[model samples]
Target: MSQQSNDEQGGQHRRAILQVAGAAAATGLLGANAASGQTARPGGRDDAPLGARLQGVQHFGVTVQNMDRAFAFYTEVLGGTEVMRDGDFKGAPVHYTLMADQEIVARERRVDPRTIGVPDLKGGAQRLDVRFVQFENVVIELLQYRDAAQPTGSGDSWAEPRDHMSPAYPRSMHICFYVRDDVNFDTFIADLEAECARRGMTQVRANRTVAVHSEQERRAAPRETNTIKIHEGPSNGWSIVYCKGPEGEQLEFVQVLGPVKKTFADAAEARRAATNRG
Candidate 1:
């Protein structure tokens, strides 16, 4: 067979696998740009205004203090498929580092001398290590700066009252994984919690699941309760829980009860049309 034919066959096989594993959630999480042949641009005014070309998240990166521990937690505990083991693909084992024209990272990170130290990688860095792991549709790039001075955590811990950080805090970001509502999600959480306990991982939030209510009703209700309010109307019936990853990165797990829509716009439009029909 021709190379083009072989490539087409390979793509079909991969799509079939994704379909069996719940293509809606996968495509929604990974973004339609990949499947639709749309090029993704950096988030800003440069991006298409209509957002039709926009795809979902392809992968996210996390800098780890200890690669082995993080790898174990993600793979052994969370069942992430290992794509590439820790290694440098380049024959010389070079560290790929870049500094923006205006030292953009330093400025954006708001580097405070008292809180964080600075590494003079202006010339460049070497011995950089990275690995890739796939959790269903999402690919997590685990990175480590071998020679450069990289902090272990974000320096804001929930345990530390003075330096505590929450989702409400600025620059605090998190990643969420989707679990099927039809499957034994509760059992899955239990097993995960047990594995974490076995590995001596600190569960920041002991509660496994939180009930969600609609936006309007939840807005009026007290916020101290165990349940969390979800603004996405399509995600109204889902249950969610939060936990701390190996490197103190915030992680979340969501069990969705409603149909997983491709985008929030689509979900909102469906609700609007339904109301009009009614």
Candidate 2:
């Protein structure tokens, strides 16, 4: 083919991609509605109706500055197991493109520095060094954007290390991890506090045990046996503490005491039933 023909074909392909992206973007609001358990349309005809597809929290992600430091804190301090690590994601085209948004926008827009943080929306991110660590039942993904034209603030992109937010804040989201009631919450907190002190990590809240739940938990229990365990002690209910990760990302550790003993054959089924009841 001639050079002119090749350029024209490329332009057509780019335009087609943008068209599809625009359509998906238009449906963003409906998707949010569905996620919030609302049927945007009546009689279940809504294509984006809320579905009980989610079984449980699979993972939560945080963007960090140093992969190694984050790994140490999560693995050594929090008792997480390293699942996988990708120092460079160049070989994975689909994953890299999804992260970088090279295909979402035309080549010209990619050079714009304003296009940062978002890959599927309007901006792109540099190829990242990603690490996945399993913290008990949930996985935590730590990401570091490499060579991206983005701000390297000490804290969040806004450079605020508040580590918390008001309930009214639209961007308020925090990852909470669970600790076993059988395990001593005080000992766990003491060890983690010592680790943070030694490593110079910001300890948002010190080791403190509070009666976070009492009658409410007992009332919620399905059986008398489960109720007997509720609020018996610091280990029988819940104890919580807050700490910052390598890049000042806020995390919470929760100790659930007297947890129910019901077992479900299918977690998804239980989740769906819970959703319906809610």
Candidate 3:
């Protein structure tokens, strides 16, 4: 199946699991009460290890132009929900949108341009526009500034300023996402490449990890340029690669090693595997 299709399937599977789990919880049939005779008090400690336990991601903020339009895009295209309205940030009226999957809750908040660490234009203070969208442990912030006269940077046209970084200098900043394993990694990369081609987006270089530099080399590196190092991990199952997502957002796709994985490692492995297959 296509990568998008796979993603849809995975999402459906997760939603089903969550539904079952939620039902079980409501009936006291899945947690400590179900597994054991005793129930721990609220805020009580458990014997589970940190690594084995599930920790949730709190929230990430993004800026956007029109809250109505952005909200529609996220909810219609990305399967997010409009949880709260007219939320407050620093006493400023803001919108708080929440999206969730089985594993995490993504909280999106709108911000005024003046609130971000940028100068206010028009010789006056104005609120910035921001939006947050979260999905399955991932939080994406979309930012849009109110004042056009202010010194602003470019970003993926579809996304607001805060959703991305200034692309004036290429390879300066990027976001990464981790995949399950090599098979899923390969599927995702292929799917993305195909989608880009279909959408007429150009394909840049793709490769595996290698020892290209160290901290010393990085220090000596020129101001306008830097090396992108790709190297194999201990298990060699996970990999990494960099690419530009819609609206020119620097994105890194990582293939995770074990059950729980990191986006960087996953991207490195995916790049490597793609290179080898090619």
Candidate 4:
């Protein structure tokens, strides 16, 4: 089968896996069926309602500059599969590749930075060279936009590292991932830390949570606490940390206690669910 076909098949498999996993979690049977790879038939004793159940991550969409290079880097270096190619944004002709494994999910695409609200590149003078890689069920978008008229400079294109949003222009944004269990969570963090160390990269701030409050939730007193920092301790119910990926995109890793619900089977499932809910 072609890569696209493989991706399609894998996506379907992932959907079924999420539904089974969700049903399992709702009935207080978390790891039993997933580890065993055997789920109860439609009318079996193991079946349960699928309301607010924990579903595995479906997939993530990322933006990139060169599809070929991005595909090679993710598949070879990051240990992901070049599953398939599809459109990036709605109605846009740009294409992206979906990559996933048992532990993480990601999508890569070549995008124009201006579309994301970058002002310096107005009038088509700035050409953004970018790609994205998501880990642990979270998306990490990588950017390398170049102004054909200017030289490359240093410093985060978005903003300085902080939890609170300031008046300063937004420099970067990141997608956070919440792990299912502590053992798997720590293992994944250690692996990523080791990989960064081996590459001689300076490990940035490794904390349990970002102190800055989310702008979207500022008005709501008692903000929803969904983040944790790993540097504090391992036994804690929540853990949070950040890493810099290729082209310097801020990658955040989070681990929250209790189970999380996987809303939809695939991207299509998610769309359908949204429509139904609406």
Model 3 ranges off by over 4 Å: 1-57, 61-127, 148-173, 196-235, 258-278
**Candidate 2, residues 1-278: lDDT per residue as tens digits?**
57865565455446545543443333332245545767546644343335543334556888776666677788887778877664333222334335455444545565642344333221124344566777656677786655444433222231223445443467856678777758765566556655776887653334223333554442233322221124543344545666455566666767654432222225557777777774
The candidate, 2 or 4, that scores higher on lDDT is 2
State the C-alpha lDDT per candidate: 0.53, 0.52, 0.43, 0.41
Clashes of each: 1, 1, 35, 19
The best-first sequence of candidates by lDDT reads 1, 2, 3, 4
Per-residue lDDT of candidate 3, residues 122-141 (tens digit): 22243233444555555555
The TM-score obtained by model 1 is: 0.54
Residues 1-278, model 4: lDDT tens digits: 47865665456446444544553343344655656789667764345445434344444434433334334445454665432222211101111111122112221334443343332322234433333343444333334344444333322332122334222347546545444554465456555545655655432223232354553342232222333443334344456656544433355666655222222225557766864563
Model 2 accuracy (lDDT, Cα):
0.52
TM-score preference between candidates 1 and 3, better one? 1
TM-score, each model?
0.54, 0.51, 0.38, 0.35
Off by over 4 Å in 1: 1-54, 85-98, 101-126, 148-164, 203-235, 259-278
Q: Candidate 1's residue-wise lDDT over 47-109, tens digit each?
A: 645544434456688766667777788888878976654322111112112224234545777
Cα lDDT of candidate 4 equals 0.41
